[model samples]
Target: MENILNYIEINELISTSGQPSVEQFKQIADNDFEVVINLALHNASNAIENEDKIVTDLNMAYFHIPVDFENPKASDVKLFLNTLQALGSNKVWVHCALNYRVSAFMYIYHKYVLKTPFDDIDISLFEQWSPDVTWQEIIKISYDEIKNA
Candidate 1:
């Protein structure tokens, strides 16, 4: 059994952070109907080998978010949204070295994209699991860059 960073359910996506075993992925796939987003810093050999096959078989898209979950780049978020929309994928799986990136991204998506209130967020879960690093500043900076772009 490999170590698990985080496992969360967001909408229809099953976002997993960290190195999950083939068995774990299989279990997730079993229950997942839409797509699986892998936000891992590094993927297991089995995952890499079977990714396309599994995605095709399950009718899911595998998105790889390029950023250190703890210290994510704004470009990464932009790319993530772009890729998802480009693929017409509504369901996503966002994972990373830990669930930090996935959680932060969700927060941003809900607050910015979905226009959800900050106070409505489950801050405790994010605060508990996320790195102490301040991503809000980074997100703001990134948002500005995207707006400029």
Candidate 2:
């Protein structure tokens, strides 16, 4: 099976990537990903039509957050975490356009929720492209909000 775009296996249970094609969704299921969390808009470029139905048909839970790329909010981060929490130990695959949104969210999740050290966090996912001012602010604000909460 072809690898999904920008795929990053975070762990045995958690993976991240850019949008997957209809056929790749089947590969995801074949690999035992029990949940698929989509951060891109439904109409995003290359997004599959009826993705929820596609994933559900594969017997995988689907959660779509549809984050606004230019205006990410702390509430989005909170909801992402809550979704993962609700899913418990299930294997999950999270994705967004070019994996940018997912990378930023995963950064906050690792730093704040998982308490991973700044130097220890795998930053390669984001280092490939510099985050603009808006994303930088959201990243800082997101972790700060999570830290203080």
Candidate 3:
């Protein structure tokens, strides 16, 4: 509801997205998101040049995961979950270039870490466009690790 690009409210505390413009960052500030997490590659076409600065300038926390689209690892998923958990109850905005990466990671997080009901999640990415093979494997591997652990 904050004018974020590709914004999807995973719940009251977490949201996922594509890259947001400068104006949208202000909207995030106005809407009171306490933290911003970015999973996009730094060289991604729409990647903000100084996104950390922008978010911090708006007085929000920023975390960059920089996932490899070609070779997403289970460890990255672990790190993401850890970061989210460490943030506690703070409202967070998680994002990637086109929401492809964000959506995949969110699927694992919501399903495992948060124990969110499967029926509540809108997984149109997996249902419709679907992640590429690499992401699919990452999601599978991450889910397996969570289930096994």
Candidate 4:
């Protein structure tokens, strides 16, 4: 029910809730961007029906990250980052159902891959988006992965 254009920041990357429209897709394609990552598999069935046209019409390379609503995997975060790097996309849109999973992935990407300090991350970013999940566990998981990696 949220607007697709309302994006949240996970460090330098941007994420949104659910699928984008033809106009939103065009905005991404027209921007100085290379790839768009869709992390909305939690709402896959609905997103597919709603945004298939925009996705198919854009004709850009994207990755669908499967996030376990109950228990997400570190490997999923790794895969998401790997996909972004492989695409060489400077501007990427990482999104998920209500932006919860995507936000967690972004936290991992920034904290580990980009070496951004946790203090620099604003908690408001996640709160503003209405992601119906707590990120404490994922944040801890990401920190461990980043520290180890």
CA-lDDT, candidates in order? 0.57, 0.85, 0.84, 0.62
- lDDT tens readout by residue for model 2, 1-149: 23778888776789999998998999999999899999998888878899999999999999999898878877888889888778888999999988989988888778767787888777786768799998997778745585454
lDDT of candidate 3 at residue 66, scale 0 to 100: 92
Best by lDDT, which number? 2
- Give the alpha carbon lDDT tens digit for every residue of 1-149 in model 3: 54566678888788887899888888877888999999999999999899999999999999999998888888888888889889999999999988888888888887787777989877876665567888877776645685444
Clashing pairs in 1: 37-93, 39-95, 39-96
What lDDT does model 2 reach?
0.85
The residue pairs that clash in candidate 3, if any, are: none
Candidate 1 segments exceeding 4 Å error: 1-5, 12-18, 43-59, 69-71, 87-89, 130-134
Summed backbone clashes in each candidate are 3, 0, 0, 0
In angstroms, how far off is 124's CA in candidate 4? Answer: 1.9
TM agreement with the true structure for every prediction: 0.69, 0.91, 0.90, 0.72
Q: Mind giving the per-residue lDDT tens digits that candidate 4 earns over 1-149? A: 13464465543445454456667677767654446677766355546554544554676556677777667766776777777667553667766655667766767777677787888864555666544444566666645574354
lDDT of 1 by residue, 40-106 (tens): 5544332455564666566655666656645667777777666655645455555555566667767
lDDT of 4 at 31: 56
Q: Output the number of the TM-score-best candidate.
A: 2
Tell me the deviation in Å of residue 27 in model 2: 0.7
lDDT, model 3: 0.84
